[model samples]
Target chain A: EPEVTQTPSHQVTQMGQEVILRCVPISNHLYFYWYRQILGQKVEFLVSFYNNEISEKSEIFDDQFSVERPDGSNFTLKIRSTKLEDSAMYFCASSQTTEAFFGQGTRLTVV
Target chain B: AQSVTQLDSHVSVSEGTPVLLRCNYSSSYSPSLFWYVQHPNKGLQLLLKYTSAATLVKGINGFEAEFKKSETSFHLTKPSAHMSDAAEYFCVVINSGGSNYKLTFGKGTLLTVNP
Candidate 1:
């Protein structure tokens, strides 16, 4: 089965630095999403992307966060001025229609 | 406005025993319910989903879920458990009839299968 893939399973970045998490969703998927989970917390939705634009975003996705589908296969989430609270597991997901498939996730650590 | 509640935080079962993980949901409209399994260091894998087509939904790994609209419950079950089935289980609810694409996840249930 084809699955979504994320790069750099783990990343460590300094506070106030910029970090970008990359993902390659399933080839035929039409919708993309980003979710995050703080250690011991429930998964929280960050944003959803479709047709090269963001469909919806949560309050947690403030001015510092941005998402881009720079290419047909690559979808990325960039955070400017990373904060200590940014430390969490970020997941990328894609779906052709109803059900979404998730990637292994990228663990972001800010210090 | 949509949420899921997993009744159990942890469950311990011996190998070859039946397993049940309870879940209750709150949605204004007809909800699209799903059960996902997360193994250590792995992504969330979809176990089964109820899209209103059938009340009893069967999925991979001999897992199944029944959507009881009257009860507002969608519970996951397996007739026999295996050591490999130990993992964190999440009950997810999506408002398919609504315009929002967000998915509400439960706190999660950790299942430990013993020998």
Candidate 2:
């Protein structure tokens, strides 16, 4: 079955540096989303993208966060200035409708 | 607002035994419920979903979930447990009438199957 794919399975970056996490959702999917899970915490929604625009975002998705569909296949999440609390497993998910499929996730570590 | 509650943090059962993972949800409208499994180092996999079509929904790997609107529950069950069934299970809820289809996930319940 076709699945969502993400790049840079693990990343380590400085606290103040900018980082971008990339995802290639299923080819035919129209809606894309980003979610994060702190270690030992429930997965939290970050943002949802559709038609090259953000549909909704949570408080965690503040000024530092932005999402882009730069190409037909790539969805990227950019963090302008990373904070220590931003370290978590970031997941990219896509769906044709309400049932979303998730990628393996990118583990972001800030120091 | 919609939320899901997984009753157990951890459940242990021997192989070949019946397995039950309890879940309860709160929704103001008709809800879309789902059960997802996450194996170690892997992404979340959808087990089954209830979209108000049927109350008893069957999914892959001999897994099934019952949607009880009166009880506000969608509990996952399997007749026989396997060693491969060990993983973290999450119950998710989504409000179809909402503007966005953001899912609210439960904290998760860890299941361990022994030989």
Cα RMSD, each candidate: 1.3, 1.1
In model 1, what is the error at residue A69, expressed in angstroms?
A: 0.7
User: For residues B20-86, could you state the per-residue lDDT of candidate 2 as single tens digits?
Assistant: 9999999888899999999988889999999989899999899999999899999999999999999
Range of the 10 consecutive residues with the lowest summed lDDT in candidate 1 chain B: B95-104
Candidate 1 local Cα displacement, residue B44, angstroms:
0.9
Tens-digit per-residue lDDT, B34-83, candidate 1: 99999998899999998889899999999999999999999999999999
Output the lDDT of residue A56, model 2: 88
**Tens digit of lDDT per residue, candidate 1, span A91-111?**
999987779899999999999
Clash number by candidate, in order: 0, 0
> How many angstroms is the interface RMSD of candidate 2?
1.2
For candidate 2, lDDT tens digit of each residue in A1-111?
899999889999999999999999999998899999898888899998887899889999999999999989999999988999999999999988899999999999999
